[model samples]
Target: MDLHEISEKLQAGAAKAVAALVQQALDEGYPAQKILEEGLLDGMNVIGEKFKNNEIYVPEVLIAARAMNKGAEVLKPHLAAEGVKATGKVCIGTVQGDLHDIGKNLVKMMMEGKGLEVVDLGVDVAPSTYVQCAIEQNCSMICCSALLTTTMGVMADVVKAVEEAGIHDKVKIMIGGAPVTQHYCDQIGADFYAADATTAAEIAVDYCAKVANG
Candidate 1:
């Protein structure tokens, strides 16, 4: 199937159909990056907008994200095998004291769909874990999500840890969650705050591009 046909199937939330179209495109000699941008990313853009508008809820979003994920999986190995690097690398976590992961997982999926290499530190991640992962992974950005007001305070601690470890200037920091606000992100020294997954992916890819060009 063609990229346009694949993207339409994705918008309709047909996971297996989309995945097969991705494989078909790859088998027909389409570049992985082309399929990614015109197909998977385009589909996610629609899904993200629907989610923001409340026209689609979590279950539907999850299914679409899962389809996008399968497409990402099929393309990833080819991109690597062909020596094509990802746009950027990121370390993402739910922050220490936050056991919930739904929000973080969504952001991670969106980031991955945008062709980012994400090192997910999982839920209940410590400040040191984030800092260490950023250092070891050479991540261009570090993302933190906290679902509760109480756990959100840990964002400052994670930022502080990055500063103390002397890697603060080396990486951009991002924060999000239900209670996270732009004001809170600025107060906690985060470089970016995303109200949703699409904005988060946009911020990450844009930041990486700015630095790479500089």
Candidate 2:
């Protein structure tokens, strides 16, 4: 009936309930954008905080994200009619030679949960692919994930590709994975480094907000 109820259901990971509640809210004349921001995103924000604090783990986060996605799907048509655009746009991928995708998938969900439009490039993505996608999509950030130390080097290549594409100033680069650290992020001239999916999404959202305001 109310938006808070929607948020509660999403946080509880009741996908079907969330979808029904979202539709119910829409039918009750609540604005689609308001439901998205106050209901779905609000729930996701709580999940992200819990994740950052280790109060919840990946499985819980994934479940809540699924619920949020279901709710979002129900509101898609209304969101389009209302012209409710995402807060930011980002390109996310596993860097070349890295086939790991669990982290990448988690980051994508968290980013979407934060109201950022994420373009997922799948696994083994090249530096050029990152740059090209960011440019073509008008994304403000590029997120690279690599689980292996050997693949982490490709993150630096992505930074270089962005620079060569002459979009370094227009986009921010963020890297993360088991083998990445703050030192590597700085050394490679990346804008940010996240130890996990929750942090990555939070940082990426902040960067996008700053770019939007500027």
In angstroms, the error of model 1 at 33 is 1.9
- lDDT of every predicted structure (CA atoms): 0.87, 0.94
Misplaced by over 4 Å in model 2 are: none
Q: What pairs collide in candidate 2?
A: none
Off by over 4 Å in 1: none
10 residues in a row with least lDDT, candidate 1: 1-10
| Model 2 TM-score (2 dp) | 0.98
TM-score of model 1 vs. true structure: 0.92
